[model samples]
Target: MRKQPPTYSPQMTRMAFAASFAFAITAPAHAQSTVTLYGIIDEGVNYTSNVQTSAGHGHNLYSISSGILSGSRWGLRGVEDLGGGMKAVFVLENGFDVTNGKLGQGSLEFGRQAYVGLSTPFGAVMMGRQYDPVVDYVHPLMPSALFSGSIGAHPADLDNLNNANRINNSVKYRSANYGGFSGEGLYSFGGTPGSVGTNQIWSVGFGYSSGPLNLGAGYLVARNPNVSFFGTAVGATAASNNFGSSPVINGYASAQSQRIFGAGATYAIGRATLGAIYSNTQFRHLSGAISPLNPAGVEGTATFNSIEADFQYQFTPALSLGVAYNYTAGNNANDAKYHQGSIGADYAVSKRTDFYLIGVLQHASGIDSTGHAARAALNGLTPSASNQQAAVRIAIRHKF
Candidate 1:
């Protein structure tokens, strides 16, 4: 007993259908997934004093440096919805030499980060090349992380602490925030065939942030890193330590080991955040590593303990200033001690662009002729004899 529907002309029906199709084509998409593209470009000029001189010629070296102000990198990040409060995420980041368009050292591709993982209420677990727990949980409380300067890195970046960098073949697990406290732990497999124990690393760390105070602590270990041989390269090469120059251990010996323990904290005062950190590194079983001096199984051990303090001040809504100091002592074959201080100012030109100026001074005491030199040829700089060295840098950065 339904009433008859109103009739329409064929042309009218076609027009109505066309209108609906146009509205669908032009409507905003609300349920579609999203992918974000982002990157940071940081570059600057560096001036180093006390550079090694070749013979009687006194030459001044001045050059542009990338990652001096900050690490230049580009990355892609995305998340896919899986329903039930669960999701999949991935990050692919690459570090590069802005000055010469080269990949970061030791990272073939996607060197900075390449990981895929799942996130749930229990916490997030990730695999395939990631930052260790020390770097993730401990580095943020250091002056190097506060200031845009290169002097903050420890010698050889020996420990993953201070955010000195990342690792490969890693399986990492991070806990969700719990009452202003959280933690993470990681293990990296050497992945060598028939030699499962070589070149492996493991770490665990925790952090807490509540109100105006933040704190973190961590531990790390690396075993049996490989060292290859290069003929006649007596001093520190642009690639690695000059230990290859020795005849007894022609290349690096197997089973070079490292261990680290570190802790840090930050306190918010007014518009400023004050931060401090301390780290200890122990190198063991460093035998058979061909060094220019220690050619035959030099078994001397090295210990590094460092303390750093820093402050950040918000000058304006768009500008900020930071100052920091770091002192480090090593009880090793060289008995090296270093003092570093830095000051920086950053101005936001826009939401995604910024300009910055930074200055740093470094002084080393107890560096012997056989010890690691101050100018160890980092970031492609030629290796020079260990002498006192200092540097200053300024840069601009953009993120999107």
Candidate 2:
């Protein structure tokens, strides 16, 4: 009788204790969430010699440059759980010029990244201004990782395939990582009313990384990329031709749109990494007046074939050295040829900081136009001004 009385309520007693423990454990997790504020601030001094000014003047100029090592920016990112396997996610990022406190995202404050979406085991779908999949997946695997950008980046970063920039009014999709292989696709709403057919772009890209090998490929086609780089626009006319806000009078006029598709890969062995990339870019539907010296209305199609090889080695955990060689050949519709070569290096001061050095050498042959020298001088700059130029930059970058 005594033993039975003591055991009578054992199940009820255990249930009461379990409820108290669960309440204590879940109270904090339910009452509070986490938000992270992060950003990067990078700036430095840049020196370029033989900076071609006007039609026939080369001047050595020293100035403060923004984003030589990394673009300056600040952003907010957050997450909240909705229970089960679902969650709410959002990010708002703004790019700025550290030297002048100017907004980096065109005229929009949040031009760098502004998006909200749902994330799950299947994948993620996001909307707003965003980075093209090609830049996100492909450029990171190239020598540009150490050089800060691809040598193949087009004039004024007019296109994203080389990771020059991002686009507006876009929706993006990213697949969850599957054993180091993932894919992404993006569609950018041209946002130009009746001009829809002539002012839009679309892209798709993929990446696979396993062990010491990494590979990426992507394709991009724009209806009128040349218009922005070669056309005359307000505000641009006032700035230096190097900036390309307008078309210069007495200057060469070249209207050509482009389509680029290519693949790149990298291999890591021991303390060194080796990288290579091949890109094919074509310019079509060309029409423009050559330099005033010869305004016979120049028109020609151009094809560019570029190949690059790069190497990086860690001298120590904090000290590393990198070198890259890039070679490119341009064949115009008339089969005129232009060739360019480039090399560069970088050093890491810490996980979130670094310094860099780079040089480019270019030579063109078989072009028959007064603009040929101007084109070479421009080094493909939007306004095109260098017959031959060299740049050496030193910068410091910090991330939080």
Candidate 3:
């Protein structure tokens, strides 16, 4: 060495540099971390045969709408490998009105979902604002997800199958799939000083899927429906947020607590799939101040029972048709009944683009939450002035 190290050949030096560069690039790939950006946009024109006008009169209306087949949303999701069959994961999703370019979900950014947690071989545990167990494990089996989107949801989305609300300050756990079965649980804090349970929410759900059959069941309970489910502040007399404002359940907005239980199943046969769902919703400790539907300013309770059946057929790899029927009955505060029918068709333009048309019909009978004759109302639309309502929509959707 003292005699001067033999000069390294230029070729040897170049080879050494290439080897180090390759190692640097290959090492990161082995960790298996990834981040993805994704989104869906749905825009449409809607026609309603009966819609409440500014003067509280029913009138035909035409307007632009967003989120027919699916809510327009954009999100970022990421996972970082932590070794030993574990990973760190996070998701942030935002909902918006495509027509007006305004934020949805109470105008909060990332209002649809925001969570971070660890995923392991055994399960996943996340904490933040997120969908409850019912929405995660059970809602997907409902017609609302399979047929016509929000228009096909249960009356008032009483069972939350439409995911009208997202829990805040929450902790959730999802079990790893065991063969064809999985389970989920969630708890949301009230975040109220001195009252840990005043506005809390809790839910549990289980699901099973094997081949062409799928089944799901879930239960959810929310204390202080106005404050907890609607994201209103404590002591708010009326609902501050518009979540779950459908005429079918609006009168019960002041309920002290709310509970929902639901179950659903779907089976595939050839090119068609058949599904059925049932849900029971209860509103407790209602007062006249909260809803005029209560018995003459007196305290009372309310309940709704709903059932739905649906079918979907794939005419071809790029085209599909669907039909659904729903029945809902309300008791306690007011005796009301609702019947709804929905039909839809979709054609795929590409893997990421599609066109769709949907129609819905509804009829209502008996007393309503306003203490007046019940009015027909389709989900996501204004209540009809009378007992019957009809709606139709044509739309284009794109995903990326």
Please provide, for model 2 over 139-218, each residue's C-alpha lDDT reduced to its tens digit, 9 standing for 90 to 100: 77666556634322432232344444465566788888899998888776656677765646677888999999999988
lDDT of 3 at 342: 93
Model 2 root-mean-square deviation: 9.6
Taking all chains together, the TM-score of candidate 1 against the true structure is 0.81
* Rank list by TM-score: 3, 1, 2
Overall local distance difference test of candidate 2: 0.60
Candidate 3 wrongly placed segments (more than 4 Å) = 1-30, 232-245, 290-298
Best by TM-score: 3
lDDT of 1 by residue, 1-400 (tens): 9999999999999999999998775552343334678888887777765455656222345778777556788888877767786778889988888888988745457877889899888789888767777777777776666674555555444454544346677888999999988999888887669987776778899999999998989998877543211111123232354332211122223337667898999998888888888888766665645554343344556567878788899878889999888776766543666676778888999998888887666566564224333333222233334434455667788887
Clashing pairs in 3: none
- Cα-based lDDT for every prediction: 0.66, 0.60, 0.85
Question: What ordering of candidates by lDDT runs from best to worst?
Answer: 3, 1, 2
Residue 22 lDDT in candidate 2: 94
Residues 1-400, candidate 3: write the lDDT tens digits.
4687678899999999999999986786788978789999999999998788878888999999998789999999999899999999999999999999998877888989999999999999999989988888778887778668797787767778999888989999999999999999999988889999988999999999999999999999999877778753233344353334466776676678999998999999999999999988988888666333332343578888999899999999999999999999988777889999999999999999999999989999998765678899888888888899999999999999
